[model samples]
Target: MAACVTQQNPDPSFTLSLSAVDGNLTLVQGEKKNITLHIERHGGFSEAVSLSLEKKGGGGLPSGVSYGFDPSVASGSNSTLSLEVSSGAPVGSYDLQIKGSASSKTQYAYLSLTVQEKPQPGSFSLTVNPSSRSLELPTSGSVTTTTEVGIVRNNFTDAVSLSLESSDGSALPAGISASFSPASSTADKSTLTLSVASTVQANTYSLRVKGTAGGTSKYAPFTLTLTAPPSPPPSGPANATLLRSYQWLQSSPEGDQPAVEAMFYRPRQFKSGVNIPDEEGHGSIDDAGAYQGWDVLTPPNGGKHGSVWQYSKPVFIRLTLNRDARLAVVWRADPSKVPNWLKNNWSEQGSVRIAGSDRRVFVKNFSAGQTVELGSVYDPGASISQNLETYWVLFGEKDGTPSPAPAQLGSPAAEPNKPCPQWVHDQYTTEVTMPNGSKRVLATWHPQVDPVYWCYFGHDHGSDPSLFKAGYKPAFGYIQDDLHTSGVLPEGHPGFKNYVWERDGYRWLFVHHFGTGAIGRVCRQFHSLQVAVANKSTGEIVADLHINTDFGPSTDNNTDLPLDATCPPEVPTPSQVANQSNGERKLHVYDGTQGSLNGYEPWRSDVPGNILGLNLGGLTFDTVNPITACKDPGCSSLMRIGTSTGETRLFAVATDPNGPALSIDASKAAATGEFYTDIYGKKLLSPSDPGAVRQYIKPGLRLEVRNERNTECFARDAFFMFYEGCALAADVPQAFMNIEGALSDKN
Candidate 1:
């Protein structure tokens, strides 16, 4: 067996060799190209080899120019090499060396890449700061206003030439002309000067600014609202202030009677009626007896007694004691109390016995020592003998002896508890522990101003803009998204119950109350986190601004918690949309996508290839494709898009909590529970109104864009590649679950 045997050659120590199928490539900046890299295994080497690029020396690959291999590890012998150049990359030639190695043996190959200037598409774009601007020009002379314009481009960088002119069919006022500084340049920004002759009409003018670079050209719309100079202030002493007084109704009967415990504010000088003194100012009259239910003293025999007091001027007041002395009557002692008899209505008052209670006490004129006899003070009418006996003992006799008790009073009319207006509820009532201790109820009969406003405001950490940006949790609530989207709350659903408007600069919040369920369990509860303000000048409604406090976690027994001291940064980001305009705003929040319900992220495009392309350089997307990232419907109408780092990047839209994968739509107004920008400037919806949601999102509603929050973020070109529904399940993080309460099947 040894004579003819030819031993198999020993496996050679692997020697690796690398070569490129194509040794050279020519590409433009911001372009991506691929080359085939071949690995040769010699001397019977069969093990896999890993490949990587090597820097020649002194300098590395041009800034933002990168490469990678398809098969990162060479399995057999070949792999595809991918080279990419960023849009901002400088044009230059590069000599790159790639290396492949298996075992201890490595081989190298050379690649020559020629990078050329990126070609500009046939279109370029321009953006003007403050797309809508205003200027005041005097009637006698001339005036000048300036706006800055920026050139916008993608995958291209060249000197953009500029031309300014009046928009089609919208010429500038007759004498107005436009000019640009450095008419043509490669700079990103340019100043536009507008000069208006006194002869120009004072009216809004539409203007257009066009930019041309390479072979591409684009234009932007600019608005110039010209108005006459403001008029001088009145030269005389201001008009006498209207001494308006606000008297709260402390107690109201099922049927009409009179307000109990009336109080008044002393008149003071004021130039404008808008600002009212916050404190009680001063109380002039007292009506304590009316603090008790006024129905008991309804003048049994149809006698005028417990009636509303409408005081127009300073006057004498009188009080009458009932047979039992428990009932009292407050009426005007002087006829002068009537300012205008026909127009004067019953006046309400504050109770002096209770520190802060408002009562609807009777106010009417009665002659001094007037002996106004009445039958009885009870609904069924009291006995004459008993009434006389008690009356004699109390009024006739000046002694301290007490009189006999009168007959039991009849119950007031049905539905004794009528709901008060939200504003009234906030001003006169407070949350108090009920007898059963099941839930808190509004103490309607309380005697003090509701301190809820001050308490919540004290917890408003968003007072500082920076802290709000850094993610301060605010004590707020939102309507259910499902209800809002349907645009109509079901008939049996709870209505908006109570809210306070214009507190702390038009900020307000409200709650919804649903009656107990079959098992006597509380069924309905909701909260308004933020409110909207409307522009008085333009009649626009502004929503999407949050000005409030953050609340602590909710327990099974107590859904409402006290305000938290601080909002930690790690907590899920709350929903916050800046008010791009003046006034109150509205927002609808759901449990959040997968319970993380942060804001929306429109920058994370849903397009197939674009999903992963965001991390790579040199990728550009057509922004007009509604399915692409930047292509949300009507995005251009809301904002202008541009880039600064020479990269063809677009703006980021709103985001939701799940992740930055879906984009929010800014073009359409949000329905009841849908997320929305402050589409309507300063317009507000009545939380108490059943139809408020549908009315708020009516398609005919056209609110002016205010941009008060100074937000210019627009949808990136990549945002519109695909649409992600709000119902998409999100990856709920563990930390968020612990903070926002763990989710259950019902949740």
Candidate 2:
């Protein structure tokens, strides 16, 4: 027997033992409890000791009770044992064994756990002496309001803590704070004070006064009202009064005439008289004009027959002040009442001259209201009464066509000697016989004389003609080609043809066509031709056609058209090219191509996947597709226009692309801090800019495209057209052909 035992195995190399630091633990149902266990090593035992818990009876575990150890395998001197008792755990004492093993040797410790039913919580109620309180803050000082809070306890004596919070879970308004005399107290009552700083906004607030005792909480409603002090009176004279009115007499070729109609009114006064003259002389003076209020002063003619007296005359209203006073004048027009012709033809036409000064401040578009302060006028001693005159005038033609206004007394107009191109002076009128046997003037290269300049002609026709293709020969001139077939084929054919006509002592090219029903009833099926005029004798190009060829169906897309028929290579006029480097070149006109004349192009499509491509200043820009980028309601009516600066701007509606729709009264719109926003929802002008005035263009406003040279020369003679004529001045990058005509018949 191998020495038979050799003396009992030397005591195991090491011994592992376990003992519970806390032999007993009490846990309520659904509660978690922890116990500490002492894991000890004896006789040189050094290996990690595994720890576990088991019911003494050998059942998996007390029903609904789970156990875990901080260190399941313990190499330290102690371990933590956590036990979780579910709500459904058996309510009884459990004898558990904590086993610790090391190197296959095991040791055990005993633990006792008791699971008990949860105890009931004490109850309490909260109340306030007054449920609501109101306080007013001075303009520069804070205010305070107080309320008494009462706590009623039922089977509860523990201290109850008090806190205030917004009933809606939001933070208290700025500068507002709540405090209690005794923050946490067992007493039945406590004083609650709410302090508000002057900076606190005036409003009604709902607050909750919460009292918490352990896990039991109660709340009382507290209403807080804050009021702001009343505003002080304005510091200035009491009021203003109308002193007198007078008209200035001037002489015209037609004979002597009053420069303006002078009408007097008191505050809120309505006057009935022969204040306005009738254009057709069809109505009695009594039936001509009637005004209700003095707040808004309008042209005496009531905007009838497209005639505005102020356009031809200046009106002065004298005001007398008892003391020093500040005056403000505003210009407004009812959107619905504004004539469509005025809106379509004019950019800005109304203006007011500063009192006792020739300086005139132009008003915004009639549709867009404007306000200006006349500034404070000081009394020039008591002997002489304070008298001031407000001069008002309207610029533009009586027929609603844009024209230059006469220069004021002090400000001289632009130099009128700037001579126009020689060809412009030599051009003669060309007429064609119409079907009615009446001679229609087709090309009046030199029609009306410019109001400002003597040498410059006022009218010419060279621009996008898409809108007038169906009319009689355009104002310029054209040759018809009834021989061309009209139909839509793989190789497109022209439906209507127009050829170059002679003008400005040179053969001019002006080709525009509209598709007929036979070609395609769809507005998208159209053909156009791009043309340039060259001096027949010198082969020098007078106009260079620069338009996006991809805009529409061109000869390139239709093989039937002759490629060689296109305009020759551009050779800019010698003087015009030389002036460009000297910064003397003014306006440039890039003739629209046939494709650009098409009513429906890629940029105008409403399809979802199509991207927007804008042709601006001869350059193309790819912008976000309006169909997808437009998030505002009623986006379908949105329209975009390209600025000469190479930016594509948005309009509120397609029908009124020049300005925002006048949906609100002018006063109300200004009061609400509301203004127009571009397509990107950006404000066009910030009112905060010093001396900045906001202007808007009338919707459906027609644009008359004219070269800068003609506009500049004409503006020199008639100063008012300087602003109107140069509205599109920035669109020109170089001196090109002088084209003048409406961009669209409607909008």
lDDT for each of the candidates?
0.32, 0.35
Which residue pairs in candidate 2 collide?
A: 452-717, 452-718, 528-594, 552-595, 587-708
Kindly list the per-residue Cα lDDT of model 2 for residues 1-747, writing each as its tens digit.
000000011122222223222454555567776767776443345778787888752347889889899899988778888889997898766767666666645555655565655434576666664556667666776777777787766677889899888887677777889999899988988999888998888677888788888886667666676755533323442121221112222233323222222221222222111121112111111110111122222222222212212233222122222222222232222223223223333343233211111221223222111222121111212121122222222222123222222232222232221333444333344565432335655443232223222223322222222222212233332222112123222112222222333333443333333221121211121122223444556644433221112222111111212111211133222232332321110111112333221111112111111111111111111111111111112112212322111111111112223522212122322122223222111234354432222223222222212122211110111111111122122221111111111111111
**Candidate 1 TM-score, true structure as reference:** 0.20
RMSD of every candidate to native, in Å, equals: 39.0, 35.1
- Number of the top candidate by TM-score? 1
lDDT of 2 at 728: 26
Alpha-carbon runs more than 4 Å astray in model 1: 1-123, 136-143, 154-158, 169-171, 196-202, 212-217, 238-747
What would the per-residue lDDT of candidate 1 be over residues 575-687, giving only the tens digit for each residue?
Answer: 22111211111111122132221122111111112111111111111111111111111111111111100111112222323333211123343343322221122233443
